[model samples]
Target: MEVAVRVLPEGLEPIASIFEDLGTGGVLIEDPTLIARYKDEPGDTQVVSALISGQGDLPVVKGYLPVDERLPERLDNLKLLLDNLFLEQRPEISTSELPETNWATAWQAYYKPVAVGEKLVVKPSWEDYCSEDGRVVIELDPGMAFGSGTHATTTLCMQLLERHLKGGEVVIDVGTGSGILAAAAAKLGASKVMAVDNDPVAVRVARENMVLNNIQEVVKVFEGNLLQVVTGLADLIVANIIADVIINLTKDVPRVLVPGGKFIASGIIKDREKDVQRALKETGFTVLEVKREGEWAAIVSILGE
Candidate 1:
């Protein structure tokens, strides 16, 4: 069964939990207003318009379930939970049946070689690409992890990384999702790179990606929260996490950075740019440049000696 639920922003977590409890493979929350940004063809405008009908900015959360004998009971349970959660303005959910699919790998069909920077190309492990321009490639198999180097958050960090990295500098990637940034650092000429993440799944996928890129010798993956497991001086540190986290991260960044070392912070929404800037400055950093793509921003700064 396929289901799509329209709910307010605050309701996403609860509704997603209900869907997961019903044995949904994955939950996809989407804002139709933002869908236009990812569409490339002229005909896609109509599709975007169709999605925007009457939805406004309300997110549409989608999930899928297998057809089984217990499906009716699961559906009842989901509806019951939804009603108990929202009494005043209950959200509407739609459902339909879908043919059996190997959806886990099917999403990879949309994954293609993307040029994130001037010389950097993010390619999937299952895809083939010939680099006629001698561009650097970071082969990846993200699996359950998030970083595929295509999202604006990841791309912005990659662009800034390309601009600042000099040959043979030690690099650290905090909140390293799928190990994409660590691989990028190695490809961009960083001598030794440390990729850290608290999630074991991310650590495993990132390690697999490093091996896929043949960068294992240079990039080491570690499971840890933020920068807690990181020590010593780093020439550059890149974090592609949220604004509040980045703001909190400012406290420890300066101490870990070498004098004149650079820090690239992304995963910041446009509204939180000023807050991140203020925090970085208060931590004794001089903001060098801020780059914005779509609704996201990446800030590059250096700590005072």
Candidate 2:
């Protein structure tokens, strides 16, 4: 069932927190006037719009829970559990309609081969990219998923993988948006590569891309949150999610990594690099190298002894 709760004026935060606590999916919109107000008071309670299923006759509670009900306490505990399940913010673009100008072809027009590192070249499935002597070429189709090798985050992670991944190693790619990293690992001769994501749409897209690259057999795709569905230690673990998620995954990540195994992380803006590094250190990971490009940062760390 879908239920929508719109908090007017300055209520986005509280409303968001409420839905987040309830484990209900929703959207938050900012009108022009509120956008201006947001600049002045960014912390103003969030305006939330929630979508609930209509079949269920669940009591619809609106507005903040009363202080005396002890409901807020329950919601707070739920929020703590959900903090690891949901993305902090929804995507900026949520529309269902695609532009009619044939974005697939248009995007393809601008798409070109990307050189990830000295030995690897990431090429669009439609284009032919000649690999230099001893270099490997990874062909991919961006599709609806996020990574396509153009973004600095993906490139940086690929570079890290190229340098760290030895042939026939087992690799796990958490939050494998487009399956690019998993596919690349297979191409680089990793015997077993598993790519997993919480989003079913991402999983579908990643599977399709895996087929496009003809590595579906080597790269298994699964749907689940983080390491919950992934078992056993890996020779390498790559997580190219945002800083917050990386921080959250620190403890679980080390448990899934072989002793002295490497963890490569990206999708971190430069500003949050230190926070991620600190989280890794606290979780028993030693930072081995950090690479920065413009405002983005990627870290290569090892599981501590």
The top-ranked prediction according to TM-score is: 1
Best by lDDT: 1
Give stretches of model 2 more than 4 Å off: 1-105, 132-134
Tens digits of lDDT, candidate 1, 73-180:
887888888989954568888999875556557789999999987989999999989998989988989888989888999999899989999889999999998999
- The candidate 2 region of ten consecutive residues with least summed lDDT is 48-57
* Regions of candidate 1 where Cα sits further than 4 Å from its true position: 1-76, 79-101
Please state the error at residue 198 of candidate 1 in Å: 1.1
Report lDDT (Cα) of residue 64, candidate 1.
Answer: 84
lDDT of 1: 0.89
What are the TM-scores, per candidate, against the unseen true structure?
0.73, 0.66
